[model samples]
Target chain A: MLIHELLPLVGDAQSVVEVSQSGDALRELLRAPAASAYRAYVPDGEKMDAGTVVVAFLGPKPEAHIDAETVAPALRELPVGGRALLLLGWPVPELPYHRLLDELVTAGLQVLQVVPLDKVSRHGAHCAVLAARVDRLAPLRTHLSDAPLDLAGEAPDLRALLRLTGEYVFGDLLSRPLRRNLAAAGDRIKEQDERIRALEKEIAARDATIAKAESRLARARNDLADLRASTTFRIGNTVVQGARRPTRGIVSVPVGLVRIWRKRGTPGERPGPQS
Target chain B: MTLLTDAEASKYWNERHQQETDLRSGGDISFDEATNYMFYLRRLTMLMDRVGLQNNPVAPLYLLDAGCGKGYFSRELAKFGHQVDGIDGSEAAIAHCRELGGGPRYHRTTLSGWRTPWLYDVVFTVDVLFHILDDAEWERSTRNLASLVRLGGKLIVGDWGEDGDHVYGNYQVVRGRDRYLPLLDACGMRFDGWEPYRFRRSPIGLYTFTRIG
Candidate 1:
């Protein structure tokens, strides 16, 4: 997701001026360690200086054209020898990278380097980086009309073709699998994280439940033990045992009753203690 | 007269449910968005606490989520060991609820039409009745929801906790406390005090009713 291709240009820059409709590209730009002082600007009514790094993010809309009118003013502000890095959200068939380069050259910026930033940038858009040096402008008597550019063959010229090849190698071939694997791994980790959280919650709930049940069981056991040690329980036990003796069956109840009466009549006859 | 027919209501909900990817997506009210999801999460948790649904020792509380769309609350309550039945008129919504498989039985029936041999210990309808445009149908739905609750059990309704009902967006009949209390009284359900939902940005709150008979 990090456009490693733009690292070299950005690695040495101290101050970066980012122009984009959304601050997303600017935020990504500021992530580089080289960007100690980075400020973002919108294309409308914005001013910039030359000799500093400038990044412009354009497109995702093929229907919308990026003309010299939009690109020239930003470049004009850049002083001589200033670096301009143009990143397109995606390649529009109508506005090819080479045509954009031609527009920049016409606008008084010397084309230095043109390459695809990555096959797919963090925004899920194809991006190309065009690093140009601002130079003294030749006075323009006439404005160039928007016209389809021809680059010799079915493909763009060797310079553009070479950049395209680099795009395939560095952007698609190198980063695609890495991105896929990282995404899969991230998803797996996230799933496991969610599962772990759910399990922890469940375990905590079960522990509470078990503790409650254990307390309840302890209380029940204590109640049962208390019942066993009670005076009433001893009298009932004695009567039952005495009744088991067949010879004394008729007198067993009276004897047991008298014994309980004597126990109750005794001084200091506490119910549990007497039992 | 019913402004929106039963068929119209079902179609509206079914289409809306089908479009949504989750419980919080594709409605005028949504929780799928991050901010809205947070709001809904807080509101539901607070509502549960207010209704004594959180850490409830009274497990296996047979709960009826009347007009349960997509079974968010039903599934959550079922997690707390309550046997929940989620009823919705939208077939798509019921199907989606069944797919979630969180242990709540899904029934495709409107509140007025819903029938069961067993009564629920806690029957609740959250943010569902406002969509019923017909006044008579609303009364019937209220009565039917009350009927599903056992005596001394609760029937919690979610609506505006204001004095008088108002209609919003041609469908949502914001039933106020004044409108609900008499209807609940008629059905032998006692009007317990309303507990306002803590995180709701609006005046909506939990309308708790207890069946006395």
Candidate 2:
């Protein structure tokens, strides 16, 4: 058995040669005979006429390093019944390994097995391997006829079996405990909802306070404007003070009794004012 | 001091001033002094407000007055919380600007020789560049103007448009708005905006350019 590894250094060597530059390390890695078993980088998809078993060592970091654009294009070029081995450097916790295996099977690939490679030297870097044989490329071509549930023809029976099992096992042994757990979860959810409502109310109150302050500021400005208009104060230039013009003429008095007449008139005026 | 020995430029400016003085002193002007002064003051205040001078009370702004003949605009800008430096090649004009208590630092220099130790936020050259006699001087003057503006700063220019050149009183020169764009582009300057201004009943155009990388 010949084991081969296609280690790409610079350009993507899949369906199309997307990158223009080729690194020296990739050239050295491709010198071995087993490497000759795989097709080299080619730009056109139709030109990939070699390679039976295609093993794609996606990269050192599966999710972070591997280019999905390159991989998806490569997948389209694979021949039927040909094997494709995808080694992912990171394990997906959300996607169960069995479900991924089942998806590959549903996609017309017979999944031989998925293994967590612990003993392999390359496995020093965390990795998962999926070995699959392409059975039919168009498994999902006929949805009604070729669907997984339709092919099984026993999904209804399976659901009935599960219902019966739940009724017997859970009702007999663990019904009360399960109900208690569910009630506790419900109480936690209600507490969270109350906290959310309190936050909403607090935000509304803050907005109202802000609006009131803004209105008060506007009123204060209007009052200041009115005060400025009422106050008619001018600074600088002091000509408009208590300065009066002199009366035009003085009255003529008799020569002999001029002083007497002046005194008498002043005295008479004073007396008249008193009366 | 870098003075222009060009006889045409000197004669042109002298004739221009004579014409302006003649016009201003010719009529029995019935302008309300108090109202006019108040209006000018309000306009200065508004300009200061728009430029955000109030926010920066401690540090003074640096302004460049290009083609600053007698430094009227330069002095006004300095009064509004800016430290101004004005350059005009005409020696008599610079002397008159000094006598007017225009506190802005004045220099008797042509646009070609104008240099500064510091960059300015705004370079204001009003009714000046149109006096350039030829294309070479215009290009040189424009490049010098753009060089004075710091990154993200403005260059404000007011001049006679190409259409208004024939309506000259003392000095004669003409330029259009479209002519300035290519010259400014060569100097790594981009057009920001423009406004139409009429001074002493004569139509003038104002353009602004921002220095960009």
Candidate 3:
């Protein structure tokens, strides 16, 4: 499908800029949706408005030039909250999404969502609409999420340490600014660790209090049960219940007899004096 | 297009197709991304599991995606070293499938009219046969799909896995267990009970069948 046909389907965007090496797909993508300011061009480090929705239609080899070359640069320039829609056209059937996802992440973009648009787009390429928002860390850190060097344990080898330093830390780009950011990240991690410890201590204290409360509740329940079972308590409960059947009958008998005598004497007329 | 005689269904789907949104995730359905993702992932995993259980003699199983609207399942299966042929009635859907030029060969034809030179080891239809509209057409379509399955091959169908069939939105008919079990039996296929699709809000299920004859 042409870009214009596909863009509107993507929903209303403030502005859209598509970067593609190929002319035909770009032309189709640019076909008349005059409503939004949608523009298509070959990737050159042209200054795009920060929040402009940048769609990278990487035709065939998405993992190669398009991802590293085109998308990475554009993503760096994207403003915070700006979205990059990466369309990997039916390149290789076996292309795992993780690779493209990692590439997007390395460029400082956080993947918000992924939608399969293979059926809707005219090119019928295995298309994935990877919506990623530019993040704070996008400008500084420069490698994909998956690292070759294992950062788990101590790396004694000098070569391995160098590789780790190069990949993880600023080795080539060990500029003052990157170093500052790394130090800041380290400080933040330390702060988080302290906070986590405090939280754990607080949770432990809360658990102890809960346990104490539960014990008290259990004791109270047992005491109530014992009180209920006591002879005095049982007698008091019965007395509190007042008149049951037999007792009620004893009170009612005399009153019942009096009423009967009164009713028998009266009969049809009100009884005069002794009559 | 004419074979899709149910005007309401045709119109509904045609508009859906024109909407240019992902059917698996974004559509008229109120399913959020997470639910839809889980549903798709679970369905795909189940399909793979079902195929694995077969232990087919063919190294790369010859599969048919009956009523492959946008060729999602077809392409996914193709990734797993399967030769797939995707067929759909809609011209636009078929056009998109062809344009996307994955390994799966796509054809624009209804299930009833579809014919192949050779039988497939696995012929499955996902969320398609239930929308056949006419009862006779549904029967004919089932028979046609069954006819394409080789002996000892499997046919996995998607629809309502309930006891009795039900209609939804005046177009989709959830062909329950009663309707399909007998239909498969008539086609000389063994009824391998229905399995509920995981993470699906609606009772969408996978109806499994194996051609014994």
Query: For each candidate, what TM-score against the reference?
Result: 0.41, 0.37, 0.41
lDDT for each residue of candidate 3 in A238-272, tens digit (9 for 90 to 100): 44443355576565655544544555533233223
lDDT of 2 by residue, B56-161 (tens): 1233567788877766667788776678898887776777778886579888888877976466767877667766755677678878888787554578776655
Clashing pairs in 2: B162-B175
Error in Å for residue A144 of model 2: 71
Residue A27 displacement in candidate 3 (angstroms): 61
Clashing residue pairs, candidate 1? A50-A79, B24-B31, B24-B32
Top candidate on lDDT is: 1
Q: What DockQ does each candidate score versus the true complex, computed on alpha carbons? A: 0.00, 0.00, 0.01
Per-residue error (Å), model 2, residue A221: 78
TM-score of chain B of 1: 0.89
Which is better, 1 or 3, measured by lDDT?
A: 1
DockQ of 3: 0.01
DockQ value of candidate 2: 0.00
Off by over 4 Å in 2: A1-275, B1-5, B14-57, B160-170, B198-201
lDDT of 1 at A157: 37
Ranking by lDDT: 1, 3, 2
**Candidate 1 residues B164-186, lDDT tens each?**
87877655779898899988887
Locate the minimum summed-lDDT window of 10 residues in model 3 chain A. A139-148
